[model samples]
Target: MESIGTSQIKKAIHHISESVFVGLCRKVGTSQMVAMKRDVVDILEMVEYYVKTSDYYIVMLSGSCREGFRLKESDIDSMFWPNNYRVIWDLSQSHYYNTQRQTLILCDCSDSPPGFTLLYLLSPSINRGILEACIRMKNSCYISSSKYRQKICSLSSSNETEHGPCVSGAYGTLEYDNAHCLSCDFWPPSASSWIERCHSWPQPHIVDDIVNNGCHFVAIGHKLGRHEDHEWRISFSLAEQKLVYAMNHCQFLTYCLLKLFLTEIINNGLDEDDKLLCSYHMKTVVFWVIQQNTLPHWRPLNLLGCFWVCFKLVLKWVYEGVCPNFFIPDNNMFLSKIHGYKQRQLFMRLYGLYEKGLAFLLQIPSIRSYIINVLHNPKVSICTDEHTLISEAEFDETLYNEIHCFDVLYKSDIQTCMRYLHTIEQMIGSPLLTQYQVIMLQILTASLLKDTALILRMETFTCKNKLKYRADKISCHMLKVAAKFGFITDMLFIAMYYFETRRYRDALSITEMIKGKLAQPYLMYESKVDTKMYTEAVGGQSWCTKMRKAVAWDIRLYSGIHYISELVSEQQSALRKKKTILYIPSFILLYMLEVLCYRHVDTMRVQTALDDLQTLVHYDQGQLIDLRHRDISWQILGICQQLTGNHQTALY
Candidate 1:
């Protein structure tokens, strides 16, 4: 078979995007969304009633249902926050006995006669009671194994196991409105500290908002013998719901399309027993892709490109046989499954689909109909004209919304820019640029202004330097405006500016915040033993090491003379062996930062700077370092030795 060409793939993606929008929009119409919300409220009430009688305080909707990306068959995932906390102790005693005829009788808790033999394994009896209460609640809510079997029988013919527990663990499904069903998973209140755990996550301030807003972890079902049948899955469902809810119409449509493809296309091709990938994986891939890229990349016209990117990400994960859990970096969602031959099979299947492109999708009758309907439907129209006045207005709004009030800073009249900036300050709830947004803004401003003084002023504002602030109030206003955005680089620049101005304590505080964010990924990576095993195999080292180095460099640079010992202690952990083949520019920058930092304080230890420069030269074979920096490093080394009264060593 001829492989799909690039143009053909693009065409297919365009059709797929249109069909997905029409199909999902129709399914999730105003009435359907209202019904979903109503169903969720009802489910919450039912759960609240059950938990109200117990120690649990609140029950909230979570997962796809809350995230507003649910399909026709998607389950409603929910968790209840427990008020009382109890510690569990494992009594590793076996819960089995031999039959009278010497036959091995495996006592199973989930069996017809629910065995209490394993009750010995549970401690304090309170946890056991809680689990039992949760099970009873599931049965009472009409989501028990028996209830599920009945529903299956009523709906369709299926020969699958009818006596097993729900895959989601203590989750129950109920018919919401005859046309839709709701599935909810109950969880015990998290014992873990969200503030401590999420300190290092990307965008610490946003994470702070999430934690303050009541996001918590939950104990979820894992493989039966793993971790004593208990594993805490960090639940970011609330945060995710907020993110998806805030997504523009186009981004949401793209997400729906990806989910649809996973369900209708990918799942259909896989064997019933294959659990290599699922819709959750698809959602995670999209979430990370969004975080790594800018908002403009996900525009409506770029819908096809976004979907293609999502598809490629999924394909990459399948091929690698690993998918890191989004919230918990160490938790490999596919750890127990997708290994060796199974992984190869999944890769081949996905690759084959990729190769076949739209031709394979067209072969599916339902999909073909969707495509045809999307193409001809009067209600669904793809606007291709960009020259219209409406289009221009929309374009301007798009730029305004994404670029935020900062767009006004680039106006032809400087006074007008300042006025708009002042207006934005007075306005409540103005959009603030993220770190990535600031970078883009910087580039845009530079490209448009073409004025070096203005650009330097912008940089000085970003740095938040007090030294230049007295010179101009405009620069001070710009600094305040940039501070509102709170970009990561902004903080770094501010810290550096403080350090340069000898405000050591203030610089240390900002550097600590940067350290906290950078350290989060490392802490997450270190928490899971499996992460280290798959680190290199899955391309984690590249990103992980870079983040570690950032933290290391920040500590070494801005930590001040008082905290130098801490930096020295963290050196080995922070600075891993560099990859010989890949030249990381950050490594060089880190060395330079270190050299500059050491020269500013503690001249006696300037030897450390010289050593770092030497290591950098050796690692990249001097290709990255300037000859001037190398000579300066040597001079610094000699000066430090002389200052330490080692004249002979300094001369040598």
Candidate 2:
């Protein structure tokens, strides 16, 4: 019944934030954060390198994913631009252009807002879309931003809608916003002052990097600009990502906390039209606060204090009706909105919450339980006993998630596999790559090596020269390397390849060895692996070490790569839409391949293999063959039955 003081709540919030927010909750730890940042850059660079920027435009991932925050509600943000067009500040800078290859566009800033420009076509382009987007204005050709946005959106499906500069659409279960932009390597004069202001915060090296990356001209213009329909906004998104990467762990968490507060508390019950603050405005506020050095130290214990400072600044900016852009201070981010009655209402609402002080955080579901715990048992709540163990466990969870995210990020193809190998080679000697990233690289390399071997095997059937022997030898060596580096079940891919190539004896030998290994009961499974059993199986080694040699739970076959001839047509169709993956349990794939191999090499053992496969398909009860993949398991069984002339059973 006694009242809790403001400082006590602050202390409790800090402890809770350190425990809940920093590890598994929305906040990613320092190592995971570094890995996330590196992973995005590497993937984007790989896209550029492998695609040659010919089929798809060069892309840079923006937003929270690039900033290393893993909020569940976060949408994917990407900016892509064709490699053929180059945007320059003036005609004097056209010397770098190759007239045969590049179409030059000039940035016109005369009639636009501070952070926006009109793109003028300085040279003819072969792309009919670009030609159509250009309109003759004042005897000069300028690209119409509205027309360009329409052109970009037309390429997407009918369901995609325009959201500001981005073309928003859903890719499978995830929603994404892809902004079409033109890259400008030259830094804009409007933001020249930003370079000078970076002296205190973003070290000199970071400033150089940002300047080198320059800026992009996104499709949207200022609402009140003179040529609003033709204008494009100057985007410093790449630079902002770099600034985020430079922030300390505590500072980064404070930013994440601000985003959390915006979504969960500020916009909790408000309708879409009534909400004024967005994640962008919060990001701008944090950038200003950091550059100004308003907080001396951003330690974990003072995390609540940091969030409070940022919240008050937001309230002040709302009251003032001026939210300045970090790169261009003159460009009032809230110029058209956040004025008059709405401004007054938002400030009063925030001010009322401000009066509640740190207790306002109680509205957040993730932090509420901690606040209750602290209030009930103040002395014991902040104690270090159980929190340390919890932190360690969450740390392991973080490691596990980071390691597996590679499979989620990309599917295997010859180009992607080659690019991944190239990226891994570049990252191997780099100091910035973390140990977890290295582990991830090894796993991906192993998987992709299998893909490379399978593709080479497909190509071998067409060979008529000495190169065929070389390709065959190299393919065999790569599979050996893949098995050495990948999970225990990855060897099944090699067996599958041998079975396909009519090397039945070799394929059966691999299936026999794997069956023996899998019988030990220590192999991992999809999200269902028992940690204690796996550690015991691996001789009490750490998770990091065990993951390197972990037994494979499933045989993962990506759609784009030519894994099996029977599945080629289905895979080709699936590749055109999205990355399709088939998860066949290791035992099921082994048994299926074993049945096929036995039919080719020894007719006598065929029935035994068929009996084993049939038992797994019908009676395993989701033990060896997971029910999630039951359809595929049955399909495999049907294929085996039909192949061996059991027509009636295959139909059933």
Candidate 3:
């Protein structure tokens, strides 16, 4: 056998780079990341809109979700701060705030290390929670970081635990990490040099935007600081998000690749406590490399080359035992951890992998097959076109995940739902929102409309007479408008609303239409639907058009909203959960509704509806409902059994 020439290897590497780009495109969705970024911002705004109505704190979406990467290991990270409190660097800046309603805390960084500060109270605080967490030091009062974190966690769910500076909890499928922080309107004085260093990258406007957005102080302290219990770590999360947004798609993808490499390769088998490096370290490396103008160009063809450069920087930082923070270089990010014998062990592993060069990427499970394919066949043609990279299946899955992320269920009453409806309407009509934001707002409008309509109908009932009123007509119109923007399964809510209002005939007709639409077999249930099946079912038209015409996805029931009279009991536990979001497959919800509808309309067909529902629940064998949601499937079957007077079967 002849030895492979250097040119052939270079050609293989080029194909490998293209393959990596294509793989990432499919993972995050091609051209969909822009919409995802906008959607996350909208979610933050909407969440803050609702939260601020009841509480004084303002919430934010942070971490990789806001940065537009949806890796499996990516948890939902959020930061919240009281709007009436301010952290100021100078006492002169205290004049910027109204002491009557706002409480000011001076950021004392003199004794603390870089990137850390002790918050000294400058004025009396009206909030009892903050006052109780303060500690008197000589003539001054300093807020105890540990006490404040405990108070925040106490206000949250019991399942949450203290994880670094965040209160971490898991709900449904994802883990949520909530950090209590205080906002500083002015940029940190220590990072003033970063503004001058932005000339090479991050244009002047973006720099201004980042500086204006300022930063926050998370509830944590530097281990080496004297006032460790009282010190708070200055967070550049907001500014970092802006920097990430300014990055081109190639740069963003490169950052994501490095993250994947860290999670899937370097820390692959190491115990959670044993892993030395983290995604933040990888991100810091990328920021330094980009701002320093180390890479000539960050493009699809040079993706692997850029990744190589970043990896080498990581190795250098580890070998030298110094990884500087991008904003404040004097603060070594690797100071607390990544030292001693463990540091040498990590360097050895990284160096061994570095010796393998680009081929070391084969250890990553997500893109391993792609790398192997290109290496085996150097002449293989790999299409890098954005349009070609997206398959119908991937598109559907992406849309499904995006749609379901709107699953936050709150305990709202009639007044709250009406207010939410009004806010959504105003947002939808605004000219400032992007097209993607409008689409998300419209989706939210569907749910709010349904909730408000049901609440109105529920109010029109009386003991003397259950007579129809104008509320019924208003509800009908609102539900129809909701159906216009909602998924195909959302149409069931109309049937559900009608059934709840004792309109059996109307409910039956809507269920019949839904049944006909779902019969197409292209309906998505989790990741069960495939491209081949979709193409065979609706191949002639574009996938976008087909999806628009056929949008029968899964069904979700939010607590605090009147969805189904029969399932109210089932939704209580969901309401008690942290996020209060509940999910039910479309097939299960539809069949259960159909059976209940026939119980009042046609007694002869009741048995048939019940039998079909039972088959779906027990005999479908995970075809319609994914394994993760199988519990809800069984519960629906039990409900149908009890409704049909088969109490014994229901108990079984």
Question: lDDT by residue for model 3 over 550-623, one digit each (tens)?
Answer: 66666766666667778887788676665465778888888888889899878899889888888887787777
Tell me the lDDT of candidate 3. Answer: 0.81
Candidate 1: tens digits of C-alpha lDDT, residues 1-652: 2455866655655755655444445454322342334333433243234424343345555566556543555765655443343212121211222222111111122311101111111222232333342223212311122332244334432322222222232112321211111111221123133334443233576655554554343333344323323222334566676556545556666677776777777786666577567767877887667766634455545666777777888888887777876655545677667778888888998899889764555544334676676557635655432232132222222222222212222233344344333433343232543333333334233222222223345345455557457533453344434433432223444444444555555555665565465434322211121233233232322322332232121111211111122233223322332211111132343343344455566555446655665565556444334333354344444544554456986697
* Best candidate according to TM-score: 3
* Best-matching candidate per lDDT: 3
Please list the Cα RMSD from the true structure of every candidate, rounded to 1 decimal place: 27.2, 4.2, 3.0
Taking the tens digit of each residue's C-alpha lDDT, what string does model 2 give over 1-652?
Answer: 1356866665676676555444323344454545544664555455345545465468777887777766777888988888888899988878977878888999888888889889999878777778888888979999999999989888877768999899997754678899999988888889989998986899999999899878998888898898888899999999988888888767777787788788898898888788799999888888888889989887766777888889999998998998999999989988887899989988999999999988888887756676566567656444323234334334444555545554443544556667667766776676866565566667667766777777776657687768777888888899989888766677788887777767889988999988887766555554445566665667546554555455455666777566666556546654565547766777778888878888888889888988898888889876677767787778778888988999999999
**Candidate with more favorable, higher lDDT: 1 or 3:** 3
- Candidate 1 vs candidate 3, TM-score winner: 3
- Off-target runs (Cα >4 Å) in candidate 3 are 1-11, 31-37, 40-55, 407-411, 429-432, 459-468, 525-548, 576-579
**C-alpha RMSD (angstroms) for model 3:** 3.0
| Backbone clashes, each candidate | 1, 0, 0
Q: What order do you get sorting by lDDT, best first? A: 3, 2, 1
Which stretches of candidate 1 lie above 4 Å from their native place? 1-19, 30-57, 86-206, 213-230, 269-272, 358-367, 373-652
* Candidate 1 vs 2: which has more TM-score: 2
